[model samples]
Target chain A: MSDAASVQAVRATVGDSEFDRDTAPTRRAPGVYDIDLSAGWTILGAVNGGYLLAVLGRALADALPHGDPFTISAHYLTASKPGPAVVRTDVVRTGRTLSTGQASLFQYDDEGHEVERIRVLASYGDLDTLPDDVRTAAEPPAFPPMEHCFGPEDGPAPAAGTSAIADRLMLKLDPSTLGWALGAPSGKGEMRSWFGLADGRDADPFSLLLAVDALPPTAFEIGLSGWVPTVELTVHVRCRPAPGPLRVSITTRNLAGGFLEEDAEVWDSADRLVAQSRQLARVRLG
Target chain B: MSDAASVQAVRATVGDSEFDRDTAPTRRAPGVYDIDLSAGWTILGAVNGGYLLAVLGRALADALPHGDPFTISAHYLTASKPGPAVVRTDVVRTGRTLSTGQASLFQYDDEGHEVERIRVLASYGDLDTLPDDVRTAAEPPAFPPMEHCFGPEDGPAPAAGTSAIADRLMLKLDPSTLGWALGAPSGKGEMRSWFGLADGRDADPFSLLLAVDALPPTAFEIGLSGWVPTVELTVHVRCRPAPGPLRVSITTRNLAGGFLEEDAEVWDSADRLVAQSRQLARVRLG
Candidate 1:
């Protein structure tokens, strides 16, 4: 079993449903393995454009269904990488619970090509309601939950061991919505927290994209400064969040000079927007 | 000279270009256009994902530049429509100065079948500066200078006529060494800023993408809340910003339950990281 003991026995039977092992990251053409860029779930030191958009959304939720709810409506970042990077996905169509996909990532020098390319389309609705031409029914946006939020300290740390589904659904956060705070300022230099997954957990979609790729910096509750890390992140999942205290709102629309862009919506506590994310950062001035 | 009299004689010789010729919303293909989602530009009306990402970045700067300093790097949005939406673009390579293209927009439902699909990948670089090793040496983020920021009033009531390259590039707002407050938020959902041109104006890449697609909400400037207009927007330039105040950032990552995604990043104040954009929004809940 050596590929590092089958990558440590497939990272110790990850999120076991009796060990599924696909670790999905496919892509037969267009450069190859567009998703390694130094592996997933890092924080301050960087790596967490939602952990490579939940590893291109766990390869589009391993081809859909188990009560499909996915969300991450759109994303883009054609190119930008000085060091490491990789990502790969492709489904195009799986149908039934709903499927359609495409992902390509690559970055490792001499102008490492294809920075990102996507075309996701997934469906499998449930929390129902809200489609009559959706013109603001208002309601969502209350806040304060998740044991009052507080997580994320500094850079590449999470590689310990967790999985009874990443310890019953990863990336917790709810010290009151991880202490809500983040108007914007996080070009990748780092910080992340608007996280999700707690109570009776059900996260799924790669554990709700590893709980928003392991939160810690909603720019540290809005103090702001400099640092850009998300070289690229794209999410589109439409539903999935049985976990708990997930209210996330964070925003940073644009950041000139250094180059930045941020967006998050994630809601489930009856606010319902469910999934949406976008990122591409590269600012870091210490 | 009839086309609303050449758009009213180019808005009487660009007296503060804010030109608005929109009314033409209804082409399903062949150059394509259809985002009218019922004219909701200001109060975040329902379909304006930054005006369909400035009409797919003015159909990719009318398929590659010529005069202006074309900018825009990222954008994402997969679908959205209240009345109907669609766009189409493709050039991929033009090259006189530099050009490359791709634009795919499809939003239908009058029994047309497909509901949403947008794809974009545009590049037109080559003004020089061919070094790269992922630059951005540092120093940016100051916050305060959108000629004295204030917006949130949700502008839009003025505009008698404009667009001589947006009456010569007017949008403003700068300062984000990572402090976060970018610009173009005079209220009304997702809008953005940091524009150029003006002084002796002479733009082309579709008038610098209609002046950053007429700077305005792509979505989420701190919960201004849903609209999800743009169905597609993709850009990538990297150089050219001769004018001034070229520092912009925009965000609105995902919205799921209502369908959404947004992006923008343009820098040049020495902070480098020139252009990037992504869009694909479908939310409608006004």
Candidate 2:
């Protein structure tokens, strides 16, 4: 792709409308964000964590004193919905070589009450080889492709009958990486599928994580009809590894009381752990 | 001990009056809770993720429906401080048995603009045992007892001393079972320790998380002067392990542009991953 087209693609990815947050609608009318459950930007059900992550990327760009590639490493804290939220950020200490910052999130109610919260630590630095001690837990989980696992009859057909966002990418998961438990008898129960985004897009770590995070937890866990708005999704990039068909493994760890939580971890096609994700969802029983 | 004496002792251990916060001249009409940058809360640093975790636990309880146990398992999303922050939560489905939710936190300006956002997922459930396929990656980190770690020389000694709260039925950690990575290089960076509380406190999962989250992050990571107000802290609990001494590790991942971010993880002393944490801070840097 030409440089212009690449730039355009990046723009197009972000240009898409943001999630229409029905619970915490963004209040721009008063030029102040009044976090009320009643109103907020609502991302359609199509919106996934990847989309929000992109939006967050843009927001971070705007927040940084000088726009720099701020790589998110870990998130320590956060809150639940149906309540008020709060966020915090701090600059550790900026040195000539490297700089770091942390941010936290919380949910609140209309009566000026806090509902839930999350915290994140981020660092920006001149890319260099990290200390050898910084290694991932293990290679990615082993699983078949989304097609082999979910099959076409499973759920929505891929956007062009293709596995990844772009056609060329493929996730070559080594089945022996981690022993994976099979899905429930329903065939729709939680399952992990190894995936890889074709080159080009994979270079963008956020995009890779977005795709990893965007995979629906319900698809692997619960067979739900229609969209189950992901109330919240968190992604932690343990270490950025060479991108390819990164292994994306997901499982619905626990589910009850109308709410469910799923666990996900991303590993490179080479089997190195790249990122980790979890989603708390409101499943609509099909 | 007499009943009256027991009550007095308990109060002394978990005493609120021990805090000189109310008397601080810089803090007046302290919006329900005004934490001054100087003389912050004790545990870790007067102001660190632990304090915010304490506050967030209270917020989750307050926001719950009828304040049910609201056992929340949250994932850290992002962190930023000293200004507008955002946290998003997904109200996973609500059901009779268990429920799950997700949240994100962001820091923004007064104009309702997002400064940083942290996204997290949470789960609520009744305490029940599933076929526990429990295994941890590392044992909890070991450290001197809290008394030794935070002893008189560590900082201002808790007025009531260790014996004060010792009698209370709060969770007690057996550091032996916890996984720990002691800070190295003469501790050139942050520090982490693992702990498990005795199963004495309220069994409400949220309450338990709140108490554990209340530990100060600054305490683990050494070398810093003056107080820093915790803009916020978030907590995420995965599967609750047997309440015993759990490993808690903290590291100053990065610092930049007058902002800093820290990463923390909690593990059962046995080394099973309990919960992971991150914090975004705005430091005085004086």
Candidate 3:
């Protein structure tokens, strides 16, 4: 089948999927998953870290005694490729409120050697059981209303990059953030955008794995370009997102010794803080 | 021997050791070591997250094919207790620039069952090999000179917090940030302190594990505080810290539905940014 035919068939049969079915896993045992990779997930010869984490997180969430991820941290040891690998999880603790576990992704080599790639520790708890809402400080970023925002229908494809991850996630970047991408670099290191799946699926804990890191590197907006690899990323789920457009913002307070910090917070249409993330990344000279 | 006799014997022989000497291992085996927990490191009968992480980090740093930890993240699953446990490390990838690995701390129950209590992912690289510094942004936090600042030597011990970990570490909080501890709560959720080992050891990658999370939970300085346990913590070692004092500050921007985020930055006496950390913790109303 041609590329167009495959795309049409996917649209007709499966209305929405963050990743291809080939990358899906088979759970032959407890806390273990046998997963096959798909080339479609690769951005530029390497699988997107956020996407990889979402899939890995799904495996852990499904295997754990509890289901929802309250806090998760993933370290990208290497670029996971399109091949066979296994995800393993170890139970750390199971409490009345929160359960903690460690998940790892492993790929077998030619001599039947298992090489670990990505590892994470996540705390799981029911979103419904959150302590009664009592917010004393901090407010969500102010974003333009939906009518004024720019979606894919209102603009051209992202011409500055050819990333598959970008194609899968539709972004309505704040006009102020777009100037830097067009070569009129903004010295400020920050990114603000409205985000949702391209196919229009409501996000769950898994998709949030990708959403938290969806914004372009804040450094790109600060005159530094090229690939800014994230050394470590940590996300905390404050609450399950309410359906509709998710507002996202990322800011860098310090760019020192060739490294920068990216701090992000995600809010739902209901104006509830859904997730918060922080990452440490090295800036490449472009 | 009387309690005083044993204390005198220990002071004469062991000098400064939080963990037991019997738990120390030879260099032949990387990542496999029997560890004994010390009650002295416990805060309210449970091991302090920062102190436990420091021990775990030492094992990983010593066992790694390379011996430097530039970035490390730890998730507290169970409150580690006084008992026997083991530290295990898995090589994720050994690269030219950065090497990554995962370390797990396991504690056994009375029935001989092993349970994972803490897990971390650490990236290692030689401090001397970092690219020539080109940080045009992010100046260090402005602070007063040492002579003008206060030290714990000039103040009273923390009130009624029977934590030996407290005795092991000394903190000199900024006067502006000390209102909360005295019952005159500072409505602000922030903490800034000058830190050094009570035993006088210069800060290193291991001590930094303790240093980054050493600040009192950001919630305490705010109006809420009974016990705010950290669910997850991440630290980035930007550069080798210079000799002398260390400045640490933690601030929480949002307090929503009983959860708050703490962002921390650490600067060495040389005014170089040595490390940065962030943690998510549940708020306890005092």
Candidate 4:
């Protein structure tokens, strides 16, 4: 079959979920993939960092011998937008337990020049092979049931053409944490929420990448405004998550020199800690 | 002068501190460096991951236009021994605010084939240019003064040929957190300490890299023993640190499938948050 026809066949086989469709990468060569940056996942006109990571994670998963991405660290050099982009992956090392690689997402600029948007280093492994040992010192934060939280559809509607990401995912924020959106900033530098796909797709290791960064900047609760660009983000996927909405808690502990570090922990429906991430981002206050 | 002579001249200019001497890289070319990994910094016969990061960070700081590394994420592919290694850096992007780059530390294996030991991606920037705004939601962990805590020299001397890292730096563990060493595990999954160079050198961005990972793995406090090899480590240097011992706290919140995540925070003498790090590592229990 022709390359285009093969991609079409793969797309037909994928689930109807928007995440599956948008993050699906068509292999162009051994380590190159062509991905379409879907417009449905954006914050302030720029593609969401986690969503972009999911796209890169998909490409890495396809290129590497391993089936799951265990750890991924991405550096966002430039903001990316919705369009066609190419992801080039390089397998750095293929170990017995883990395979390591790097991927860079490139998009065409206004001058028709290919510019690098995001660079990522990830290690892929078989999550099923991990030892079934569990120990927890941190408990999942206390959060109300999904219905009691402030969901994406709960607040005053965002102006048209803004916050496209809200339409793509089911994000139910803790009502108390949404005071920032209601003109009464919490000043607590924390936001807790329940997250899942709107299309009822099961959350997997790949989608957990998106869940880690899907929340609004915790800085927003402290009354900081404007764009908060992530400089670096690192996520460790602990295990395959249970099928349900994930519980997520993000907090900004220190904001110094306009740069804040946000730490996120994701728990599966079984109350298992599935993923943890920390990101350094700039709070571009106007 | 020839390259060898130039390297010697450069070495002569470095401070007498072991950290400064060992981490100082000699540029072999525009983006290539030759470094000698000092034997003084080792834990359980393997080179410390943070010390290795410092070496790579030095190479990157030399190649990049920026002065200090603000963010660095490194994947430990293989454990490296003290010896000569080559670091090759690639300037990914040199933005006005931050210059991003990648560096790989390679060493010749026993089979005479060069093997990669560590791969790093870092962004360098001028800390002076950062805004003076400081708003912290997380306070430094409380601990006894440095002299009151359990200093490295206070404990039973490590049997000869073990823990070379102990002689290289001053580490005072919070007495309450050292129950694991006394056969009574804290079960808290936390380790707090005061860290500084034994040579009295003040900690900087580069040295802070080592300081972040200098403490014993928090798993030891929870009774999980044996080697804990870090799979991936990421450090965010928040600002220039004041000259004094740094207060550091590292905690493991969750451990699943023999893999654990440790989050560390470093506060400088001024009580300013200077750096934060999170690493994913395996708890190799025999």
What's every prediction's RMSD, in angstroms?
A: 21.4, 11.0, 4.8, 5.6
- Ranking the candidates on DockQ from highest down gives 4, 3, 2, 1
For each candidate, report its DockQ versus the true two-chain complex. Answer: 0.04, 0.07, 0.47, 0.72
Clash-forming residue pairs, model 3: none
True contacts kept of each: 0.08, 0.00, 0.57, 0.80
Task: Pick the winner on DockQ between candidates 1 and 4.
Answer: 4
> On residues A1-286, what C-alpha lDDT tens digit does candidate 2 reach at each position?
9997776466222223122232122433321233332212122312234533433433333344433333453322222332233334455435453344544444556676654343333444433323334311244444665445532224443323432222333333322221222322243335455554333344344554455554534443344444454544545444455744555666653343344555566666555555555555545543
Once fitted onto the true fold, the runs of candidate 1 whose alpha carbons sit more than 4 angstroms away are A1-11, A14-208, A217-286, B1-19, B22-52, B56-104, B107-286
> How do the predictions measure up, each by TM-score?
0.30, 0.50, 0.86, 0.94
Sort candidate 2 into its docking category.
incorrect
Comparing 1 and 2 on TM-score, the stronger one:
2
lDDT by residue for model 4 (A91-181), tens: 9999898999999999998899999999999988999998887888878899999889876577572422478888767888888888877
Q: For model 1, report DockQ.
A: 0.04
Question: Which candidate leads in TM-score?
Answer: 4
Off by over 4 Å in 3: A1-24, A36-40, A82-85, A107-115, A144-161, A256-258, B1-30, B82-84, B111-113, B142-161
**Model 2, B180-247: lDDT tens per residue?**
21322222234444343232221223323434444433422333433443332334454454545454
Q: Ten consecutive residues with minimal summed lDDT in candidate 3 chain A?
A: A11-20
- What lDDT score goes with residue B148 in model 3? 57
- Range of the 10 consecutive residues with the lowest summed lDDT in candidate 4 chain B: B7-16
